[model samples]
Target: MLLAVGKAAGPEKTLTERYVERAAKAGRAMGLTGFDVRELPDGDGPTRADREAASILAKRGRGVLVALDERGKALTSEEFAAFLQGFADDARDVTFAIGGADGHPPSLRQAADHVLSLSTLTLPHQLARVMLAEQIYRAVTLCIGHPYHRV
Candidate 1:
């Protein structure tokens, strides 16, 4: 599960849909199930983030929450694949949260099991979704010993 703030618009939305489709196909090919995304309501700043974080956490039933934040730890593709393999081995659900422009609130970051950063630079929300989906697909391929991830 992926919890994101704001809705994708125009071409970003189209690209996001395509990336999602590709990610799902990749996951299926790797025999990994449950690749989904959930868009949350948009609100003002930290307060909105707090509310959305609460909602996202509430829906997580014994699942690990991974919050996306600039301040979070960075991992290589191989590292990420190993991280995901841990969850898969344990049969645990993992939720990746993407906050709005104001970024994730302290409450949300504190609540996350793991805080990960896609990059050091700031990214538009829509583009982040596409990059994340592709990374997920890449990770799945890596886990299955697929040549898609060439070193």
Candidate 2:
């Protein structure tokens, strides 16, 4: 299963919905089978809600945790493909956590098995969601010998 936690803020509400819908569709096309997206209640400061949701989702699967953070390791597409292949080989269920505007709470970062960087530059939280979904679809496609990945 693929689990993501995101804030329900920024952008027009309808635009956000559309991006999420596109992501879900992309996930389906990639044969993810189980894709779960959770919207956490907006918090005044850093929220522990993503971590809490992650823990719950983690219990439902084998728990290969990957968090998207600017400070994490940056991987090329091939590297990402290799990482996913290794996870699949280990028969682990992967959960990719996307945190809120303030970024992931300290506890969540510490709990993550793999902290990944999508880019060095910061991205808007909502845009990150759509980018992550697309990358996931791309990664899965690469793994399955799909021609969708040019590299």
Candidate 3:
């Protein structure tokens, strides 16, 4: 399940929803089931919100926790593919948490099984959500031997 905290603000509402919905479609196309998405209230700061989101995700299931952070490790698409494959093989589920504008709380960073960086540059939280969804979809396709991923 991909859990994103904070409500979509102004320009981000439609785009974020569109990407998430598309991601779900892509997942279905690849026969990947149990794609769950939960959106939490936006906390005042990165630390507070991340902690809250982490708590919510912890209750869901026992799986790898991947936090999307700018300062986290960056990976190539192929590397991401390998990570996803390994994660699927070893865990019952993979939970990805995306924090809001100010970024994730330190507690979340500390608790995450893996901290993934989309890019070093700061991106709006809404766009990041969409990008994360798209990447998840792409990763699923890559893992299932779909032609969607071009080398």
Tens-place lDDT digits, model 3, residues 1-151? 8777776666566666666676566666555455756777666643676566655566546777888999999998778878877866664578888876667777778888999999998887778877777677678777777787797
* Candidates 1 and 3 compared by TM-score, better number: 1
How big is the positional error of residue 131 in model 3, measured in Å on the Cα after superposition? 0.7
Instruction: Tell me which residue pairs clash in candidate 1.
Output: none
lDDT of 1 by residue, 1-151 (tens): 7788888789877776776776677777656686887888777744886777777777766789999888999999999999988988888888898887778889989989999999999887778887787788778888888888885
TM-score for each candidate, following the candidate numbering: 0.90, 0.72, 0.80
Output the better candidate (1/3) by lDDT: 1
TM-score for candidate 3 = 0.80
lDDT of each: 0.82, 0.65, 0.74
Lowest summed lDDT across 10 adjacent residues in model 1 is found at: 23-32
Better of 1 and 2 by lDDT: 1
The whole-model C-alpha lDDT of candidate 2 against the native structure comes to 0.65
> In model 1, which runs have C-alpha deviations exceeding 4 angstroms?
none
Residue 67 lDDT in model 3? 88
Quantify how close model 3 is to the true structure by its C-alpha RMSD in Å: 2.8
Name the lDDT of candidate 1: 0.82
Q: How well is each residue in 28-48 modelled by candidate 2, as lDDT tens digits?
A: 554444455555543453446
